[model samples]
Target: MSRTPHTKTPETAPAGGKAPDPARRSDRSRRAILDAALALVGEVGYNKLTIEAIAARAGVGKQTIYRWWPSKAAVLLDASLALAGDAPTADGRTGLPDTGDLAADLKQVLRATVDEFNDPAYDAPLRALTAAGATDPELAARFTERLLAPQLALYEDRLRSARAVGQLAEGADLRLMTEMLLGPLTYRWLLRTAPLSHAFADALVDAVVATA
Candidate 1:
C-alpha cells in the first residue's frame, strides 16, 4: 500500500479544534476597536485618547490598531463614520431622505441630528472630537474630510433635487443653502448656546426654502 499525501485546505482545522475564520475574526476585532475608540473618546476626551488605551480597551495590541490605521485620530474617525449613517452606499449614493418634500425631509433629518446631539452617548464623543479638531489642524482636516464632508454632501444632494423640482431657485446656491441650513444647528450644538429641537429644525428648513 502507498502512503497517502496529506492535503490541508483553507477551511481545515488544526488537530484539536475548528479552523478560525480570518475574515470573521478581523470583523470582530474591527468592531471592538471602533467601540473601544468611541467609548474611550467619550470617557477620556480626544486629547487624551491614545493607541495604547484603545488597544487595551479593545483587547487588542497597539500594533493591531497601527496595522489598520495610522493614528488615534484615524481610528476615531472610522468609529465616528461607522456610527454616523452618512457614509455613501455601495452604489455611491448619499441615500438622503427625499420624499419629494424637501422641507419635511430636511426637518426630519435635522430633528434626528438634534436628538443625537442631546444624547450624552453621542454628544460627549462629538464634543471631544470637535474641541480637539479646533486646535489640531491635522485632526481638523481629517474630521472634515472623512466625517463632516460626506454629511454636508448629503444635504447638498437633497437641495439639488429640490432645485430640480422648482422647490428651490434655479440659481440656488446649494452649497450655501446647505451651510445656512446646517450651520446654525452645528453652532448651537457645539457652543451649547441654545436648545436644539424639532421646532428649530423646522425654522432652519423654512428659512432655507423661503429663498426659493
Candidate 2:
C-alpha cells in the first residue's frame, strides 16, 4: 500500500516572520520518515522491515534515517508517535480532548481510539510492533517511553481534572483509575477474550464513574 506522507505541522510562529527554524524543517523530514516506517511495518510485519525499506519508502536516503535513528525500532517508535498525531508541547504536555464533562470526554476519546485500534491499517502494524517488542528489550523500552507514556499521561491529566471538579472522589488514584478504564478493553482486544463494543465502553464508564 502507498503511504500517505505526514504533513501535520507544529503550531507555527507569528505570521510573515522568519519562516520556521531550520531545525523545524528537519523535524518535518523526520516525521515523514516515521510515517514511512509505520506504513511499512504495518504492511509487512516488523521482522521483514528494514532501514533500507523505510528510507526508500520515506523518500529519504538511508543515511538520513541513520543520522536521526540508530535502528528500525527507533524509526518505528517515531512513526507510532507521528501516526498518533501527538507531539508534546514545549511544556512537555500532550493535549487530550477536554470537553469539561469527564465522562463524555473520556468516552469520546476512547471510542475514537477503539476505532483506530481496530482499523486494519493500524491493527496489523501495531500487533507486529507489539510482538517484536515482547522479545526486544530496547524496542520495548522505546515503545513504553514514546508510544505508551504519552497516552497514559493524557489519561492521568483527564482524571486529575475530574477530581478537581468533584466528578471523581478526592484522593483518587489517577493511575489506578486510568488502568481500570483501559485494562478491560485491552484485555479483550489483545486476548480476543470477547467483543469490544459500544456497550462495553458505556458499561466501563458507568462502572468507573461509580467508583470515582
Candidate No. with top lDDT? 1
Per-model CA lDDT versus the true structure: 0.83, 0.76
What tens-digit string does per-residue lDDT give for candidate 2 at 94-163?
A: 4666678887777776676677667776777778898888898888888988878778888889889889
lDDT of 1 by residue, 105-174 (tens): 8887888788888888788888888889999898899889987888888888888888898888899989
Q: Given candidate 1, what's the lDDT at residue 33?
A: 99
Clashes of each: 0, 0
lDDT of 2 at 80: 78
Instruction: List where candidate 1 sits over 4 angstroms from the true fold.
Output: 1-17, 86-93
Supply candidate 2's per-residue lDDT for 9: 34
Worst 10 residues of 2 by lDDT: 86-95
